[model samples]
Structures are given as C-alpha cells and as structure tokens.
Target: MPLVETAFQVVDAFTDKAFAGNPAAVMILEKFPADDILFKISREFNLSETAFIVPKYEGSTHEFHLRWFTPTAEVPLCGHATLASSHVLFTQMTEKQRQSGPLRFHTLSGELSVEFKTAAPEKLSTRNEMSLPELVMTPDLSIDRNVLCDAFGITENQILFVGSCHWGVLVEIDASTTPLHAIKPNFKAIASVNASAILLATQCGTDLHGEYDFISRMFAPNLGVNEDPVCGSAHSVLAHYYANKLKKSEFKAFQASARGGEIHVVYDAVAGRVRIAGDAVTVSKGVIYM
Candidate 1:
C-alpha cells in the first residue's frame, strides 16, 4: 500500500522572527510507519527533531499518540517538537478536530496537553504544556573532561558541573566567555564519554532584554544533533537548578542556538513539576500524498 504523510514547519517556543526558533518537521500518519522509514525521513529532513503522530486507545478522550525522534535515535521527551506537533494539529488538521480545544498526547515521557488559540494575521498558535517528571540528580561523573575541553577548545576549569539526570552531562559556563556559534563539540569523543546526551548552559543573569534569567544551548550528538535550538527536557532540569539557586519559582529562559528560542517556565515545587510554556507558529502547511 502507498504510504501517507503530512508535514508542517513548526516554530518552537520562540518569540522572534522566522528561522530563529527550532524548526521541526511534524508528520501525521494514518498508521504507524516502519522504524527504518521514520529514521530515513528524519535523516532526509535533517532538522533537530521530527515528530510522528498516531492514534491511541481509540476514543479514549486522548486525541493521539505522539513520538519524537532525532536524526539518529528516538528520545523520551522533546518539548519543542511537542509544541510543534500541537500547532500542526490545531491549524492544519480538520476543524472538527481543531475544536477539541486541547489535545492530549501519550508519549514516552508521559501524558501532555496542547491548547490552541487564534492569533493575528489569521495565524494560529498552540500552547503545549509538557509534563516534566521530577528530576533526580546523580553524582557519578563518568565523562572524560578532556573530550569536552577539546571540543569547545575551552579549559576544563571553566565547566561547572550542575547535575545529571536520565540524559547525561549538565554543565554551566560563563555567558560572556562562550559564543553560541563558536560551539563545536567532538561528537565522537563526547559520545565516548556519555551515552544519552549532554546539555551546556550559561548564566545570562538579567543581561538580555527579556524576562528570561539565563541563556542555554543543548548538544546531543549521541542522539544525532550537533546542537538543539531549544530543549524542553533540558529546561526541566534547568528549572530545578535555577530555582534552587535563585530561590524563585518562575523565570524566563532563552536558548541561544542558531535557531534561537525562548520559553516561559514555571517551577511548581509543591507539585514537583516544571511547566515549560511557549507558542508554536505554523510556517507551512501541506499534505504528502504517498
């Protein structure tokens, strides 16, 4: 049988112009496609991430089942893609489905909700609230400090260890000392040290003319991304780290990657959840008749 596909260009939680936000190619499938096919599509698109949607537990109140994949492998949770997928469903999907208000997705991370709203210029925006599970910081340091130093051409002393979660390394550096475009991680070497992924961030400390408190960049070569424009899961860990340090509950964060993006984060200490909220814009909409 012929394969069916649809694609949408979704701007991640970014408030600036086009191409500034993380662009994810979202595909809605009538049925689940083969793993090889999905990986092939991801490689062909060559974006930071791609999302595939399939129905789950027919008529169970939940709208669809979602999965996210990078160029090389699948990840547990992706905040930007989740927001993008919801935007695609709201603007491009049929009106009958669009009126559903909020869509529920069953993902590897957990159940997530995406709400839709109509904005100016006849454009639509979707607000995706990711359910960031509680983060458990680990003390084991298995990474080769030499590999990280060699990649960015920086000394090991500059890197400050924040903590580790299910992902991998979480390090912080001075915002002024490093430039976003200057990052060049040795994928092979970094992969050799860590298995899951690595997140590198810097403290903006109220420098940027925005509500965010800091700026960040995420690298997951092991997951087939040289650097992610904006990472939702990383922010979950970041929210915890910053909340503990700043003693604040809510703050703004910016991912200073080439495709820059912003996120409004709320840390619920009582609930043990970090809510990362952002608006997703639909740049293009079309169907793939396969």
Candidate 2:
C-alpha cells in the first residue's frame, strides 16, 4: 500500500488558552480519502474528534466542506472541531477569506455557520460563534437507573432527570448533594448502559454566586472516548434541556473535565437552532503521513 502524507494541525477548541479545551486534529485536503483511511488517521491521533475540511464552491454558504470523525466512528456533528476549523481559517488562511463574512460549512449535519466576531485579534476569542445542531426528545426512550448508576458511579438517587436525543443521553444530577465534578465514572461500565445511546452527558446548575450558570461533563465510551473535555454538540442538548427546566434561554456553561472549558450558549427558539460560541487556540502544527 502507498503511504499518503496529509498535513494536519491540532487546535484546542472552546478555550482561549492552549491545552484547556478539547483538541482536534484538522486536515485540509483537496478531497477526502476513503472512510477507512480517515478512520486510520483518526485512530492515530487518538483524540475525541478530528475535523476534515476541503475548500469548495458548491454550497450556498460555501467556503469549505467539513466532517468529524472519532477514533472509533464518524459523528454527524461536532462543535469543538468546527471551532478549531474556524480558528484555522481566520488565522491561517488568506486575508480575503478572513475578511469574508460568516463561513458556511457544508457538513453531514447540514449547513452550519461560523464567523469571526471582531476584526481586531485581541477580541477575537470572545466571538468565534457557530450555530450548532438542534435538539430532540426521543419519546418513550428508557434506560435502567441501576445501569446508569453503575456506569457513572453514582447512586440511583443522584440521577435527577434522564432524557434522550438522536445525539446522546442527557442526565441532570443533584449537584446540591454530590459535587458535580467530583464524580468519576467507570469507563468500563459505560458501554453497559444502553446500546442505542452514543454519548452520556451529565449536568448541574451552580449556586447564585457561582462563576458559571451551569456545569457539565460528557462521556462517549461507545465512540472510544472516555471523556470529552468540552463538547459543543452536547451543549445543543444542554441548552434546550436546561432552558425548559430553568425557564431561561441563555447561559455560561462549564465543562468540568480535567481539561476544562467555557461555552456561551443561546437557545434561539424562533430559529429552532442553538448558538454555541467559544474560543479556540492552535497548540501545534504538523503533518500526518498516512
């Protein structure tokens, strides 16, 4: 087999500083290789997700094509990778593309948009905004509480609410009693929870004086990721789920993984889309010869 060398960059998404948020390896290819090849490259990077981008003029909001792959599978939507891609485009691409308006990425999840918020470099991190995937309630979806308890290492009483969507399952835990970030899940038991679910995200609200409005952690053992540092796609579910429960539509969310990150989320009911905004920084640049 002939070895193909693909240039790649790794960027930590959803954080202004390096090594804080989720890291995604990005490859800007002329055209995508076969799926098996993509999987092999993703597995080598061993990150939560790798984003593949191709420049094209086919779509309505066309500047680039986007896709996300985990070590084990290709996911339909990924927020942090998208953030990293946007960071690459604005900072590394030609000046013309940077000056161009909000970028429209043709993805498996459909047309998603991301734009640089400011012309100045210093304030750019405040506004790398991307309109993300929508949320859905999988009606009548059920998972055993004991199964969840075993997977997350929490008692049945700590599981406050359980909900499912096409993307993953969302659970509200009682942070008032148990410290939300202190709970360490049993990764080996995650696969035993539910075969249908791909990701498991747990969340809780902060006190009145807390730094953030809400805090969450995501796990996707089925997808070969024990914990996702800062999950953008999961926030699409969290934003709406908490909105209905808290009777609000916007928030500052914290992902409580060891490599923490902050996200600003807005649930735009009128448009039926969730807007997740965060900052991304490039940590390293390299090439992967596949």
Candidate 3:
C-alpha cells in the first residue's frame, strides 16, 4: 500500500504544563481509515489513548467527527483524549473559528461540546458535558473484598467503599488512614478478574483536603491501560459517586497517578449531565506517515 501522510499532535490534558497530565496523540486525518489501520496506529503510538478526528458534513449541528482508540481496542468515550482533541482543533482553527462559540463533536457516546477558555493557547481549556454514569453496586457480580484488596495491594482496613459502576468496579480508599498515591496495583491479576475495568478513588485527606476535594485512578488491563494517567470520562462516574457521598454537585478532583492531573467537575441531577472542565497543553506536533 502507498504511504499516506497524516498530521498529529500530542497533548497533555487536564494540566497547564506539558508532560504532566494524560498524554494523548491526536491524528488529524482527511477521512476515516480502515479499522485495522486505526488499531495499528494506536498500537504504534502505545499511549493510553489516541484520538482520530476529521471534518464532518452530516449537518450544521456538528463540526467534526471524533473517535477514540486505546492501544488494544476502541472505546465509546474517553475524557482526556477528547480534551486533547479539542486542544488540537482549537489551535489549528482560524481566528474566526476560534472566536465562534463552542465547537460541537459527534462521537459514539453522543454529541460533545468544547468551548475555548480564551483566545490564547495557554488559556485554553475544555468543558465536556456528558451523561452521568450509573454507579450502582452489583453484589452478585462483584469480586470478594479481600480479592480486590489483594489485586490493588491494599489492606482490608484501607478500603472504605466498593461497588460497580458503568466503567467497572469502583473502589474508594480511606486516604485518611492510608495514602492513595502509594498504591501499586497488580495489573495481571486485575485483568484476570471478571470486571471489564476498575476505578479506585479516595477523598483527599490532610495532604490535599483543602487543595482538592477528591482523588482517583483508573485501570483497564483489558483495554490495554494498566493505569490511565488522567481519565476525563471516568470523572462522569466520579461526579455522581461523590455527589451522593459528599452531598454536593461541584468538586475539584485529582487523578492519583504518576503523571497526576486535576479536573473541576459539576453534576446537575436535573440535567443528568456532568460537566468536566480542565486545561490542556500541547507537547509536540508532527506528521505520521503510514
């Protein structure tokens, strides 16, 4: 096959500094490539997620079509990657388009909107509104508490709440007693479990209690991400989980990964949507020939 050239940019989402948040590669293509090609490209990048975007013409409602792919499989929704995609698009746009209202994206999860925070790239941020995910506990399908602790390398006393959500099993640690950032998960064992994914969180303790409201980390061995540095989509579930636990709709959240990042979240029960807001920084721009 003849090689085709595609433009790409790597952006760190949910942070103002480069290489600090979730790193996602955005491939700006002229048209959709074969599924095999997309998969291979994602694997080649070997990042947590890669976003593919192209101009759309279905209607005046949407300006572009966006898709997200992990190293192993395609996903219906991805938060950090979506934010990175918006950063790339906003930077590439003409001053006129940049001045327009929020850009609309057609995606598998549904139509998403991202408005530029300001005209400057450094001031740019993304506000993604998504339907809140169900965070109900499934006692029958849930793994034993002990087993989950073993997989995450934590003690029984260290955990506070364990349940199931739309993304996977949601576990909340007692950060007051133990540190959330010190956890080292057994990824192989996590993948062997029945759950499709796992999300662990903790309400910030003395260390970050005042600085941030909550902290979290996501693991999806089945999806080729052992620990997602910063997951934006997962926050939709967090927004609902914390809203019920904390009795509030607004929160400042931090992802407790090595490359940590923060997100500002607001959940509107009546609207049935979680609005996640955060900044993004472009790290590199290049062309991918394939």
**Which ten contiguous residues of candidate 3 have the minimum total lDDT?**
126-135
Let me know the TM-score candidate 1 reaches against the reference structure. Answer: 0.85
Q: Provide the clashing-pair count of each candidate structure.
A: 1, 0, 0
lDDT of 2 by residue, 139-252 (tens): 334777877788777777876678786687777776665565677788777677664333443444432227776888888888888888889988888877777778899888
**Residue 162, model 1, lDDT:** 47
- Greater lDDT among 1 and 2 belongs to 2
What lDDT does model 1 reach?
A: 0.72
Which of the two, 1 or 2, has more TM-score? 2
Q: Please list the Cα RMSD from the true structure of every candidate, rounded to 1 decimal place.
A: 3.1, 2.9, 2.6
Q: What are the lDDT figures for the candidates, one per model?
A: 0.72, 0.78, 0.79
Which tens-of-lDDT digit does each residue in 184-214 have in candidate 3? 8888878887766788888866335458888
- Clashing residue pairs, backbone N/CA/C < 3 A, model 1: 212-252
